[model samples]
Target: MFGRGFTLSLSVFFTLFIVFLYGPTVSILVLSFQGPNGGLTFPMRGFSTFWFESLFDGVGVIDIWGAFGRSIRLGLVVMVLTVILSLMAGLAFRKRFLISSFLFYATISSLIVPSIVISLGVALEFRIIDDAIKVFGDNMGIQWVVDDFRTTMGLFSSGLGAQLTWTLPFGLLIMFAVFNRFDPSYEEAARDLGAGPWQTFREAVLPIIAPSLIGVALFGFTLSYDELARSSQAIGGLNTLPLELRGLTTTVTDPTIYALGTLTTAVSFLAISIFLILFALLRRRTNKPSSSKRSTL
Candidate 1:
């Protein structure tokens, strides 16, 4: 049994933790709406939408908006690939073999290594590969890596291989958890009912795992979308939202950056809310009809 003093202490800790986490976000949102030229001062003056307006007008519709679009696209690609690779690696891991050992080690390595270190190593590797290709001039044995449009989509050939190397491990761990809990009986039952392994997985396993899969995908998407170091190194100074925000801090000391931050935070929050609501609705729909309705039938 827990003591009263312990409970009080725990409650205080949680209250402080929550406040620490959310206080900056609340402050940023408030500052975003504060008048443009005044800067963030106490005893707030009148509210204005000038920052939001300036975001569209001053930055031009192309650069900021285009970078936003590219970031979203990169995030989507990373999520899809991460999920696919994770699912494959996870399922493979259920088997006990040397292959599983290699994957296990790979996943752990990704988690252990620092992101900046990984980025630097990858960039160097790519540079070496580029040099080889240039020397051979069409007879190269193999190209190491290159930063190009494909990298924009989080592709390895485009020099995001190292970034994926980092993200895929976390993703694989998530999928491993999902697959670990999956009972073999489900597969057996499906096979007994004339379903092949692939068919069984498609109908029996995937549907059940859909929600967890989506949650993992969401995490991967957000992780890659907000990633700064990998994007900065892998793409060779190309700007994602985070990179842009950091660059903007140097010259554009306006409320617009705060506004952009607020916007990003709001969009992420709204998205998570919508996903939760939709998940609940879908779950309710999948439940069997009430006993009263069944009896009436």
Candidate 2:
């Protein structure tokens, strides 16, 4: 399918895409170093790390550290939970069940649905949950759901739900592809070699797919880290980095916002680098030729 015509057209398209992707990144990185007296957009007013220093020192109006910390914590939580749950769901999907078709469609549906719609549904569901809890508490004469309960739930419930709607579909699909391409003979061979199920997965399956698992985790973390629409109506009390960054857009007229974007992008790159290193190590460890395949020295 890759004819000369296709190659030429694809090359142009790919080049344009790369430019589109990296243009904002480069702009943000450069502008983030604007001098203390710089304007929002280019040309360079001056070159300084004043804005970046302002990041740690809170040069802007909003709580940069607090919002940043919240975003990191939420992303981490989502990453771990997404990896484990999606792996389980992916494996479960391998075996046919009574509602397998329904579950598959439901999982796929989450991705096709608009983020705003899912966010709205999560918000409404949490509201219903709060109301139901109140009614049940009143009937049982239990005052356990104090303001604390409401506060915690407000921060976590809808936010978590909304984010899961976004992350789970992606994780599930990745795992589905991983499993579909997996060779069952490997597992059977492991079993024949007297390895238990846990042993088989640990020493056989896991090492092979560890990189993809890392990829899903990265996707989960980054998705939740930058998520705005889901956390827009879902998160209460505390705003994430993206939301606070949005707040900066209205209140501040400097490149500090670009600094924030740069910081986040740097964090994403760092995470990606770390995952790649781990993946490389795993690949090296698992890529050794088998004893039978090894050549005599």
Who wins the lDDT comparison?
2
Whole-model Cα lDDT per candidate?
0.71, 0.83
| Model 1 alpha-carbon drift over 4 Å, by segment | 60-62, 138-159, 281-297
Off by over 4 Å in 2: 1-10, 59-61, 143-152, 290-297
Tell me the TM-score of model 1. 0.85
* Clash count, one per candidate: 0, 0
lDDT of 2 by residue, 128-212 (tens): 8788887777787776763335633444566877888889999999999999999999889889988898888877788778888
Tens digits of per-residue lDDT for model 1, 200-257: 8776677666676677677777787777776567665446677777777776766788
Clashing pairs in 2: none
Query: lDDT, candidate 2, residue 106?
Result: 94
Candidate 1 pairs with clashing backbones = none
Q: Which candidate ranks first by TM-score, i.e. highest?
A: 2
